[model samples]
Structures are given as C-alpha cells and as structure tokens.
Target: MTNKLTVKIWRGKEQGDFVSYEVPRLASQTVLDVVTYVQRNLEPSLGYRFACRVGMCGSCAMTVNGVARWTCRTHVSKVVGEGQLEIAPLANLPVVKDLVTDMSEFFDKWARAKGSFKGKRTRADDFEPVKPDSRERKAADAGVECIGCGVCYASCDVVSSRPDYLGPAALNRAWTLVNDVRDTQQRERLRAVAGDAGCHACHTQGSCTVHCPKQISPTAGIAGLKRVVGRAAVRGRL
Candidate 1:
C-alpha cells in the first residue's frame, strides 16, 4: 500500500473548482474509500452522496479519472496513474454540491419516457406464466437490472447537447417494458418514446454503454426502441 496518494476532487456546485487532497493510500482501496477518507479527515465540509458501499446501490457513481464509473467498485490501483486521480460529479446534469449531482432531471426523464410498467393483471386473476426462453422475456431480461445510477445519462453526449432528451437510461427502461409480455402499455410507451426528445434523439455514440457499471447496454436498448417505434409509426400506430 502506498502511504500517500494525491486526489484531485471537484469541490463546488455548478461553478467551482477541483481541489486537490493528499490521502494515505491503503491496500485494495476503492475510489469511494479515498473520497471517504478525505471527507472524514481532511475536509468535513466536502459533499458527496452514497448509501450502500456495495455496487448494488449505484449511488456512488462519479467521474473518476476522466471516466464515469461507480466509485464504490472502482479500485484506485486500477484507475489511478502517476500517483494522481481526478474525481468529479457525474456530467450532463446540474451539480448540487461538490461531488453530488442533482438526479431529479435524470429520474424525471424516466417519467417522460414512460418507463413505468402498466400491469394488466389483477390480484384475482391467475398467475401469468412467462417463459424465460421467450424472446420478449429474454429481451426484457437483458436490461432489467439497472440501478438508476445515472452513469449512462452522464456519459451520453446527446444529453449534454440536448437538455430535453429523455436519455439512454430512461429510453432503456422503456425498452425493457416494451418487451415485457405482461406490460399492457406497449403502444403508449412506444408513443412516449417515439418523438424527437425520445429514442430518436440518440446518436448512438455508445458512451452510455461504455460507462454503465451494470453492464447494461442502454445504447442497444435505445436502438431497439427506435426500431419498434419506427415500425409502429409506419403502421400508423403513432
């Protein structure tokens, strides 16, 4: 373990600077560990947000070493170079504080994309048997594990350029539902994600897929939506 390490962290809201902090490096320390050390020991006033330290929560995502990643799962030894690191809040969103970004817009885009599942079943009805091997189920399965970490949203260049864009994550969520056999909102979901602010806006830069810590390809999902919605529009369902 290196006894000392230099960490440069973004230390302001929408208009601030990255401040450097010298930290004692420990064996197998993750980037979140380094930020915690600084917040606890060096600067109590520093701001960041996290819940579960494990990768499941997806709350500790930040731009570390010029890449958007889940800091809790990002090991310092793997990402750090030349004994220095740069950490900042997720890009393409309004910064709340130091390393904390405002996620309201990101989550709100999910609503705009009609990402919610509209179930057709009632409690009195029999259980719906969905085969895991079925094509729709399998397609939905591919993107169901997103933890809403905003990594894809932050990495997307489209979101940076177009504020009204529904973003990859939200469009991805809509894709999952569009493939669900039990979801009754297929036509509505397609309509919601069909227009300019929806899946059509994706340039397919693939930054979202590259930065997703969960390995979910939001780019692929958004592409799927475009195809499905395009067909619907051609079929006059729009």
Candidate 2:
C-alpha cells in the first residue's frame, strides 16, 4: 500500500464543503490520528474536538464514511474505502465549525425528557440501598453507562426529520430515571416522554444500537419507556 491517504475533511460552519488533504498512512493508524496529522501538518486552521484518545471519552465522535463513530477507536484500515476517507461533523445537529457540532440541542432534549434524578432524599438522609439483583435496579442499570456522546443522536433519523424529537440518548436517559425506584418524579417524567416529540417518535430501526461504541441498546430503553408510559396511562397516573 502507498504511504499516503486522501482524506476529505469538512471545513467551516453549516455552509461548508469537504476539503481534501493527503496524510501519512502508518501502522495502527486511527481516524483521530489522521485528523491530528492534518491539523498539525497540513492545515493549522482546521477545527475538531477530541479528548482521552482511548474509547472512554466519546468526544471524538464524528461521521466517518457516512457512519457516526468514535474517531479514536476507528482504524483507518477498517473504514477507509478505495484508499480514501470522508470525515465530517455528526449529523442531525448544528455544526459549529468543521468537525465540531453544537451539542446544546442534544442536551436540551435530555432536560426535556426529565432525564435527571429527582429524589426525596436530602444530604442528611440515610443512603438508599438498592439491590443489584432486583428487577427495578437491573432495569435502571441497563441504560446507565451512556457517556453523553452524540453518536446515537446523530445516527437517529427521527431527530433528522423532526428536530423536536428527543433523540435516543435522551430517551435512554429517561428510561434509566423512570426505572429508578428512589426517584419521585416518575409520573411526571412518563408524561414528558410519552408524546410524539418523545419516546413515541422512535421508529425502532435499531441504528442507535448498531452504532453505539459502548454497545448500549437505546432502542431497548425507549421500548421500556413506551411500556411504562402505557401502564401509567392505563392507571390514570400519566
């Protein structure tokens, strides 16, 4: 293989185009490495975001070859097609510049879903014991490992067409809180996530689950929310 790779990186704001650059191809080359090389060598003005070059921090997520992924974990050899690569900001969000998308809307939807835990306990209250083996705890634990990465949000088509739709991450977060036994806002949260702009909007195509670097099933979480909402409506609690 030649020691050079042609990478088309998106530049500028919402109204930008992909600017191609030739980067060195090395062993164990990652997409992040290519971007870094371009930023350090080819272009000094390029913009992107990355932290914790390992897979733990999802700040490196971007559209690689039309698929949302963590650039830190994506190897050049695996995703490069025809000796070329296309890197852009995550989809379904406003691009601030180049590969950096404005995540304010994504987090706003999380707040709209009432993803925060609202409990009756105060700092002086005794620690609430939650058995890991219990069904409720298990359900809450299923979706709690989210890193707030925008990959799932960008992969969701519902968010693309309907900007008001709470994306997968927000709904998954709400599902976790809904299952929290110690939370006092279950009824209100269920109502918040029940309408067309919430869990009801998910088409269940499983794209979020497929592209999640953490192997999380936001689809499962959304489905659980649906069931919980249905039960609440039946019980006149919604």
Candidate 3:
C-alpha cells in the first residue's frame, strides 16, 4: 500500500476549482481526517465545517468522489480511487466558502414544509401518553432520528433539476410530524407538503435514501406524504 494519497479538494467559494494536495495515508483514517490534515498542516487557510467528529452532528458531510457522504465516518480505504480523493461541498446548496454550503435554504424549506410540531395541549397540561406499539407512534419513531444532515438533500437529483423543490429532508420531517398524534397542525402540514414544490414534486429517485448517513428513508416519507395529501384532496379537505 502507498504511504501517501493524492487529494483534489474544492477551494474557494462556488466560483473556485479543485486544488490538489498530497496527504499521508494512515490506518483506519477517515476522509475527514485527511481534510483536517490538509487544513492544519499543508494549508491553514482551508475552510470547512465539522463538529462532533464521531458522526452524530452530521456537519462534516461533503461530496466524496461525486457522491455525498458523512466524511466523519467515511473511511479513506473504502472511497480511495486510484490512490486519489476528491472532496467538495455538498451539492444543491449555495457555497459559503470551501466545503461549507449555506444551510439557510435547507432549514427554510423545513419551515415551509411545517416540519415543527404544534401540540394541542398547553404547557400547563399533563404529559400526553403515547402508546409505543401504536401505528402512529411507530411511524413517527421511524423517522424522528434525522439529524438534519444534508446528505439526503445533496444526493437528491430532483433538487438539481427543480431548484424550488422542497427536497427530501424537509419532506421527511413533515412525514414524521404528520404521524405525531399530539401535533395539531396536520392539516396545514399536509397542505404545505402537497404543493408543486412539495412532496408531490418528488420523482422517487431514492438517491436521498441511498446516500443518507443516518439511513433515514426520505423517499418513503415523501411517499407517505403523497398518500395522505391525496386522500385529503379526494375528501375535499386539502
């Protein structure tokens, strides 16, 4: 095995090109480690975002060899091609600098999708009991673990074609909220995800599911949203 790896990293903002660097290859080294090495040793000016390097924060997501992944958990050995690596900011989002894309649009779409829960009970009320075995609870539990990572968003091809598309993460969050029995905004949330740029716009490419580091199936969530919205529309309640 070679002791060194060639890395081509995107430099500057959205307008810049890839810059090549030679980095040391080590045992069990991750892609984030390589980028960190380059920034700390070779080029201190290199800009990137990372927190909770163990992979929980999902802030270190990037495009590795044309695929979106969580660099914190992506092993260099698994992704190295011909002893080389290419790292860039997540796609489909505005680039802030090098490797850090603006996340405002992503969160904004989440809000537009009505991803937050609006409980019917007041703060003075007692805690609501949710049956663990109930279908609604199960469905909600299935997708409640999303960490707002952009991996699914970046991997979505529909976002590339339709810039206004609400994207997968937002739809997935909406689905989770729709299943929450305690939520009082189901009608509005369903309507929010039913528009042209909403769940109806998804092409079901499953790219979001394929690349999600959290293994959350935004495609499945979008499908569920489609069914709910369709039923509501058929009932003339949408």
Residues 146-197, candidate 2: write the lDDT tens digits.
9999999999988889999999999999999988889999878999999889
The sequence of per-residue lDDT tens digits that candidate 1 reaches over residues 53-128 is 9999999999998889999999999999999999999999899999999999999989988888788789999989
Model 3 lDDT, residue 42, Cα: 98
What ranges in model 1 sit over 4 Å off? none
- Alpha-carbon lDDT, every model: 0.91, 0.93, 0.93
Per-prediction tally of clashes: 0, 0, 0
Q: Which stretches in model 2 have alpha-carbon errors above 4 Å?
A: none
Candidate achieving higher TM-score, 1 or 2: 2
Residue 226's lDDT in candidate 1: 85
- Poorest lDDT segment (10 consecutive residues) of candidate 3: 209-218
